[model samples]
Target: MISMQIRRLTMLLFVFVFAGCASQKSIVADKRLEEKIDQNFSDAAAQYKGMMRRLPADRFPKTYYAQTDKFQTGASSDWCSGFYPGTLLYLYEQTKDQSLLLESERILKVLEKEKNNKTTHDLGFMMYCSFGNAERIQPKPAFKDILLTSARSLASRFNPKVGCIKSWDKVKSYHGGEWSYPVIIDNMMNLELLFYASKVTGDSSFRNMAISHARKTAQNHVRPDYSSYHVVNYDPETGAVKSRETHQGFSDNSTWSRGEAWGIYGFTMVYRESGEKSFLKTAEGMADFFLAHLPKDTIPDWDFNVNQSGYTPQWKYDPSKFAEIPKDASAAAVAASALIELSQYTNKKQSKKYLKAAEDILWALSSPKYKAATGENGNFILKHSTGSVPAYSEIDVPLTYADYYFVEAMKRYKELKK
Candidate 1:
């Protein structure tokens, strides 16, 4: 790990240099919508504070089902462990609530041990979301140490032969088939941690691994339309492509909304970090593809091809139930946050298009259609996120990460307007 002083300097340099250059002067803010966004943040502050009060000491919030009034908790090892604290940090950043900060700090101490966890590739989702934001807001030597260690742990999952990070080791009977050396599109999101490792430690190994992984995913995981497959199994021994499948989407060929969102965000971030024109173009293609597929309300179904003619779901749903298919606000939240950053990397015309798409999403999320009531949703802010539809789990629920990225997008929106 690099020294904390050097790491801090590196982070500062990255923020100044790679942060996008979209001109926000022409970006006009809608007063009524702005007020609504403010209220959403304010409500999120209270909702999370109330949640922290009721939360178990050792558990992290995952998803909440309002219909059943069931608030679910996951262990510290769960991929979602970071979003609770991450959301708290965002709320605290906007509201300056001591309660939020104290809660976030409390969770971070428990979550710090995962810095050494090597079993999962979600350290970015689990560590960077919490510790990354923590370091940004309240930089500390300990935070730096934790982040670097987490980066190392995440790097351990990369198999050089595969040219990508392994998403799941092997799984049998998972979503109707077996997977070996699977490299899901979601894995692209984890590359940010590797980039951070290289930037601070000045180690090209981490950067090279990240570049290789990004290139491989951009080449294989995308369809002709730039829509992403949920999973792409690879040959670990020869670095050859085996098959592409979907674990969470409607079908193997269908586009899972969150998976596509991850690619868009990941490529945009990779572009920012590496200054690779190819990654930027890839991100722009992905953003355009995702935007072109949005529903009338700008939210996305759990999978984009759920009802398309050529795509059939792995699980059978009644034909009458087609209209009731759950939408994924989590996907929207993630994509909106990414689009805000992606906007900075483009020309004025394309920037406006990306920003407009993001604005539409943010506006919809702030409305009653997707935003939860102030104190409802078990103190969770947004509702209607589909976690894993094929698993029949957390469908149409309020997810912690959804709340994390919603506020994150709102924060970016506020800053962009300023």
Candidate 2:
């Protein structure tokens, strides 16, 4: 990891020197958007630099948590491939920061390795962060193989019988009923890999699979209110929806905050890429449900249905009995970024309302209760995160993806500045 950082920092320096010749005239004019972007990019770049500066000179084998002393320890890389690299690209586009580019490239290499592993359920989180973003931000013939390989790997996971990519293979040992195989909320982001692969390979099957999974989720996983379940059980052989379950939150019937956030963003992205009215309408519906239930500031508790007042009967509250209910600012930030994207795609006043909801969430994140201070144990920008719903782990800790989304939302605001 240190080597990766060093290589990235070096590349950034080179990019800085190379980008020095580019013009730096005012590219954006809306002051509010401009300020948000500037602050977000500043914070993101600082954190990336901080990670590089704090690392020890001695190299160590790169386990997930190996460089704890160097970077924030809470879920550093779990959901960060998209947030990290996406933020780096944002910074690069804004400041032409050579160091950021190098940093992005270094992280991209790490992403490529993970993409090749294919044992995990987060193909969207893994491949999108590395190759999907690489193609958009730093397109090159050399990166094509990495992107294609990653895309193919993700595409291959599409179970035709199920019409969705299976997630949670790592947890196959978990004692669950027969209705376990189906698409997950997190799989929404991974669909881009299938779409990209379709475009790359000229294979409509990949595109069809992506759409099929999304359509199925829309029908089964998302409730009439647009709030979504974490998991939708499927018949492995027939792609039929058997039931909806929540694995990482209060209960199978409860709404996991992050799961709803994923639906808001994921469905919105589907609309953007596919130009499907149904996707856009579903995105709007989901966003509406999420924003409606959010606190005044737009941040939400870890589980929307966790019965914050704790008045529900014990049997009805089976899951929360074992775990403390907490707020998840990371989910708010990610949802905010997605809403901002949706705002750009739509001209309706409702789109603007969604954008304001995201901004409100960002404001909440910047507050002392949510945002982390310098040199703190948590290197991430936001505080009070939850990694595992069942274990009740990482509560009130800073998360890398939280920081990443905060930065990404700010960047989106900046890009939209008139």
Candidate 3:
């Protein structure tokens, strides 16, 4: 009886040990799979790079500056002002070229001069690349001082009453209306500047403003299905919501694809900086709406409602000759990158859905339909991105932001394995 009891104990121990070994093996296999996927993504990025050679240094001098082009006249049009250097940073990462970083530094110097200016609504786009990322990566004392100065300048634009950044600096003016300060969906992206400023400067006011702005946007800008208006008006004194309108889309109510991308990416960034559950939830909701609405191949038309056959011009006097404008792949690229980040910040299963969607968009961008051939200064794929209807510029060419986000997505995918 004693021997039989001992034998039963031995068998139970053996079973427990075997199960433990199996669990350990499973975990190892899962890790290996992740590593393999990351390696594959990196390999793909490298392959893509081979197709586009290193940019020639002699073609455009280091100090060569592009014109102060506006996306819209009243608001700032220079989206590429900061993005130009950002593209160089991307190139620096890929090529380990010091020249690219030097060029980026030069752009920062020029922006330093314009730090005090608030006429442009695109301070975030202009400064984030020049100062925010630059300070983080390089961290020189000079850069820090310039960055701090720029942050303060940006914070001054924040109106406490509206709980958001005021932009579009005009009321319709060749005529006039109430001095309604329009808050654009793109402003959400610039909130990071406030958050970073607060952290570095130990200013609670800046952080508070950031949170308030995000909350206000969430409440007013988002629609029933989480689609958002491109432009929203708020009472400057009471912070009351006044109206919601679409600035970039086909109509006041139409769903602009790039504007939707801005909302998704911007809200996600807000959640990252604030750790606010509400921001994350709102971002996911917006992302879900976007993913649900995008047609197969993952790229969306400029406005979801605009049919190819029945598309009309935005203005009454505008000719209807060029109705067949290509889709905005630049916006698609940025949205894809943000979705991937959202996926990782959230979880694996959720992340995979976004990752897959981003991959589909990238695959589409790679095709000839969207991509442009290499030129002396134009070595980008993914063209036909619309900036503004009135200006009618860069309407069908590769944008700086498109290239930046494409590189960014590729970088994140590579990091996933490590």
- Candidate 2 residue 293 Cα shift, in angstroms, is 0.6
Score candidate 1 by lDDT. Answer: 0.88
* Model 2 TM-score relative to the real fold: 0.80
TM-score per prediction, in order, is 0.91, 0.80, 0.78
Clashes of each: 0, 5, 2
In model 2, which runs have C-alpha deviations exceeding 4 angstroms?
1-33, 55-83, 170-180, 308-325
What would the per-residue lDDT of candidate 3 be over residues 1-418, giving only the tens digit for each residue? 9999999999999999999998898568546544543443344334324322442322211111124322221112354566656656655665665656677675566556656766665667777765666776778877767666667777877898888888777745111364488888888877787777788889888889878989988998888789877778778889887776655666556678888898899899989988999888888888888889888767776666664445443444243645674467777887877887888777667777877676667666655566554431234434556565434445555566776676676666556545
Query: What Cα-based lDDT does every candidate model obtain?
Result: 0.88, 0.68, 0.67
Which lDDT tens digits does candidate 1 get at residues 1-418? 4699899999998876655332332324555557878888898998998898879999999988767777899999999999999999999998998989999999999898999999898999999989999999999988988999998898898899988888876564345557778888988888888888888899999999999999999999987789888888888899888888878888888889999999999999999999999999999998998999899999999888887899876665555744588999999999999999999889899998998888889999988878877678888888899998777788888998899889999999888877
Superposed Cα deviation of residue 123, candidate 3 (Å): 1.5
Candidate 1 ranges with C-alpha deviation above 4 Å = 1-29, 173-177, 315-323
Q: Give every collision pair in model 1.
A: none
Q: What RMSD does model 1 have?
A: 11.4
lDDT at position 60, candidate 1: 98
User: Which regions of candidate 3 deviate over 4 angstroms?
Assistant: 1-77, 171-179, 307-314, 317-319, 323-325
